[model samples]
Target: MLITNQLGQVLVQHVDYRDTCLLPGGAADKGESPAHSAGRELREELGVTVPLDRCLAVDWVSPDSVSVPAATRFPGEILHVFDGGTWDDARISDIRLPRSEITAIDFAEPAQLPDLLSPPDARRALSALRARLNSAGTVVLENGCPLAPGVLDRIGVLQTDRPSYRYPWHPGPAPHDRTVTQVWGWLFAPDGRVMVLLEPDTAVDILPGGTPEEQDQGDPVATLRRETAEEAAARFTNPLLLGHVTDPASRRGYLRYAAALTEVGPAQPDPATGHTYTRILATPEQAAELFDWGPATAHQLSAVHQARRQLGLPRAARLPVTELTDPITC
Candidate 1:
C-alpha cells in the first residue's frame, strides 16, 4: 500500500492490491491474531513496518445468494482492519512489486477510490480516513501528495464549539483620572511612509512609545527615548508631546506627540521578543490596502493624511500604522 498523509502525497509502497485497493492484509499465522497478521503483512508488503494501534474493522466476506453482494477479495475470508502510526516517510525504498498481480501504487482523495467494494467499506477505507486527515490538517492533493507541517484547522473544533475574543478588564468604578506614563514622538518621512511590525495572525500599528516605569529615574520624554531605542532601535534627536486623552475607567491614556527625526539606519525586523514588525510608511489609503489595520485606526489615518497633503501644516510628521504577523518573511 502506498500510504500518504492527510494531504494526498503518496509515499513509498508496494502494490495497489490488484485494483481492489482495500487496505491489504492477509490471513493470520498459527497463533498470531488477525491484527498481528495485518501488521506483519503491512511491513512485508510495503517494506515499512507500522505498529498497529487499533483494530479498525473485521470484514467477513460471504456469498449472499439472495442478491449478489458487491464483489470482494478474500471471498469467504476475514478482513481485519487496523490503524497505525502516522505516515511520515517521504520516500519508499526496497519496494518489491508483483506487476502481474499489482500494476501501480498511488494515493488519491477518497472521491477517486476504486469502485469494487461496497459503499460502506469504501467509506471506512477511504472517506473516513480523508475526513480524519482533514481534521488533522493533512491536506490530500490530487496528485497523491500530502502536504507537510500537519496542523488541524481551528474551524474543525469550532464546528461543534463556540468561542469569542475578549479583552480582560477590571470591573470597578471608573477612576477620576488615569495616570499618563509615557508620551512618544512618532516621526515619519515626507514620502507617506510609516513604521510597523508583525507576528503570526496578530498585528499592532502604534507609535514607538510607552509609559514610564517605576524604575525609570527620568520623565515621560526620557521613557519614550528609552522605549524607542529598546523596541525600534532608532535614536530620537527630537520628540515633542502633542495631546493627551484621559479615560478614568481605562488604566491609562497617551500624551500623543509627533516630531521630525531621521530614520538614518536600517529598520531591523522584530527581534521576535514579542510579536514585532519593522516600520513601514504608506499613504492612509495605501496603508489600509497593504496591511491589515483596525477600522478606527485606519479611518483616523485616512482622515489625517490625504495623498501626502495635509492642507496647511507647515512641517508635520506622521506615518502609517501597520503590522504583519505571518510566518513567512515579507
Candidate 2:
C-alpha cells in the first residue's frame, strides 16, 4: 500500500525493512472516513499529524493482486491526495516507524512508479494533475476515472472544452431523441470535380447534407444515397464506405458515417418538388486547400492517402495536413 500526494509522488516511511522503499498506511478503525483514518494512522504510527485534504483513491489489494488475511475487514489504504501541506523532509526525521509489526519509510519519486501499479486511467489523471501544478493558476479538474472506450484509434489529442457525442461535462441520465439522423452526400460534377456547398451561416464548405426522415432507416449509406437524389438530383454509381466519426455535438453519444463517390455531370433541380441546389465544382486539390476536412476527417484522409501513395497508386486527393517537400511550405 502506498499513499500519494496530489502530485502522485509517494510518501515514504523509513522503516527497518531496508528503509528505502515506502508503504502506505494500512487498515482503518470502524466508522472512520478513509481520508480521516489515514491522517490518524500517520499520527499514531509516526507522529506526523499532517492534515489531509481529499481522498484521491482507495488502494485495496485485490484478492487476485495481493495476499491478504481473509478474516481482516479493511478498506486497505486510502490515498489522501493533498496540496498546501506544511510538512517537510526535516520533520520526518523525528517521526517513529513502529518496530513491533511494520517497519521503515522513505519518499518515492513519480517516475519510479510502475505502469502496472498505476493504471492508464489513474496515470492520465495523475499526469494532468501534475501539469496543473507547474502553472500555479491552473484549475485542477478531477478526472473521475473515465473508462477508455474499446473501439477505434487511441485518443492522442485532448480538447478540454470541446463538445462530445454525449454530455461528458454534464454526465447523468437525461432524455434524448433517437429519431434525429445525419445525412451526408458526395455530389460529383462532369469534369473530375465535386460539388461543395458552404453552409449559409457558417464558413465551412462541405458536401450537401441534411437530416434523415423520421421513418427512414438509420443506415448512413442509405441516408447519403437518399440525400444525393433529393437535395442534388444526382446519381452515384458506386459509393465506397469510409470511416465514421463521432459528432462533435455530443462526442460519445452521436455518430456520423462518411462515404465517397465519383460521378459525371452537374446536379439538376428536382422536377417533382421544384427543389434547386447550391452546388459548385471544385478539384480535390482545391478542396484540400480551401476546406479544413476537420481534424477527425484529416486523420482518416491521411491514413487513406498514405496507404495509396505507399503502393504507388493514383491518388484522388491531397490531404490538408500533407507534408510539404518544399522549404516554403514547411
Candidate 3:
C-alpha cells in the first residue's frame, strides 16, 4: 500500500537487503488479511496505526517483472495499493523506524519515485497517486497507465467560437484583449444542489470566482480560495481541480478558467470587497435558467453538472424557489 502525507509525498522505506526503496508494506501474515497486514506493517515499521482508507489500485506482477526476482518465494503477485489519508507535520514528526529491517524512512514526492524505487515499484506508486487524485474507483494498471477498461477522459472543457460578452457593470476589462486566468468552485450541497452567487443589481447568477491577482502568481487553487472567500464568505473542503477551459475571444485573446468540486460553508459579507450578493442554492436546471449571462453561461453550468456526474456524485434535483432570498446587506 502507498501512503502519502498532506504535501503529496509518498512514504518510502529503505530496506537493508534491497538496493532500491519500496512502499511501507510487506507480505501478509498467516491469518492476517492484506489490509490488516498493511496496518500491522505500518505500526511495526513507523509506529503509526492508520486505517487503510480504500484500495486505490490493483497491479499484477509476474516473476519476470523488472522489480521481482526469479528466486522469489512467489512466481507472481497481485499488489493491492491502499490510500492512507494525509498526515500532518505533527504526525510525521512522530514516525519511528525500526533499524534492523528498515535502514531509513522518508517521504518522497511522486516525481522522485523513479530514482528511489525499482522499475515496477515506481510504476505502482505512480498509478496509485494518479488514482488517489483523480478517480473514485480502483484503477487497474498494466505498467503505469490505466488498463483497457479504464479510459482517461478530459474532465473539464467546453469549446465555443462565439464572441465573448462584457457586462457594462463589469468591475474590470474582459479577457478578449489579452490572456487571462480565473478560478471558480462548484460548491455542492449534501442535497446535490450547487450554490451560485447572485449579482443583486444585474440580476445575474454566477459561480463564485474571479480573475487572478498578482499575489496569486499562477496557482489556480489559491486564487479559488481567495475569490470564494471574497465573493461568498464561504469555506470549502476537498477542492479537486475539475479542469480548465480556453476561450480565444477574451482580453488576452484567451481565457484560462479552472473549477474545483467544493463543499460550501456558512455565507457572510466580506468587509474588504463590499459587494452585495445574494446566495442561491440551485440545481443545474435552475442555474441554467437563472443565469442571465446568455447561452454560454448555461453551457458552463451544464458542463459543471456533467463534471459532477463523471465524478460519481448523485444527480441534482430541482431545489425549492423559496430558498432564493434577497441580497444580503453588508
Query: What lDDT tens digits, residue by residue, belong to model 2 across residues 123-225?
Result: 4334333322222222222232213221000121111211212211111211254333454443333333345543322223446555655445655556666
- Those runs of model 2 whose alpha carbons end farther than 4 Å from true positions after fitting are 1-180, 186-193, 199-204, 252-275, 288-294, 303-330
Model 1, 1-330: lDDT tens digits are: 224443333232334433255455556899998767877777655555666655533444444411344554334555454555345334344445544444545554333443543443453354224333323322332212122312112111111111111212222222346566545444445443543322223333345666677656746667776666656665544554444544445566555444443543444444325543354443333333322222233333433443224332233333222322222111
Best by TM-score: 3
Cα lDDT of model 3 by residue, 72-177, tens digit = 6365577888887778788889889886888898887565688889877887787676566444468777655457332111110001111223222122234343
Per-candidate clashes come to 26, 21, 9
Q: Rate the local accuracy (lDDT) of all candidates.
A: 0.42, 0.40, 0.61
lDDT of 2: 0.40
Measured by lDDT, the strongest candidate is: 3
**Model 3: how far residue 241 lies from native, Å:** 18
**Cα-based TM-score, every candidate:** 0.34, 0.32, 0.49
lDDT measured at residue 265 in model 2 versus the true structure, 0 to 100: 35
What TM-score quantifies how close candidate 1 is to the native fold? Answer: 0.34
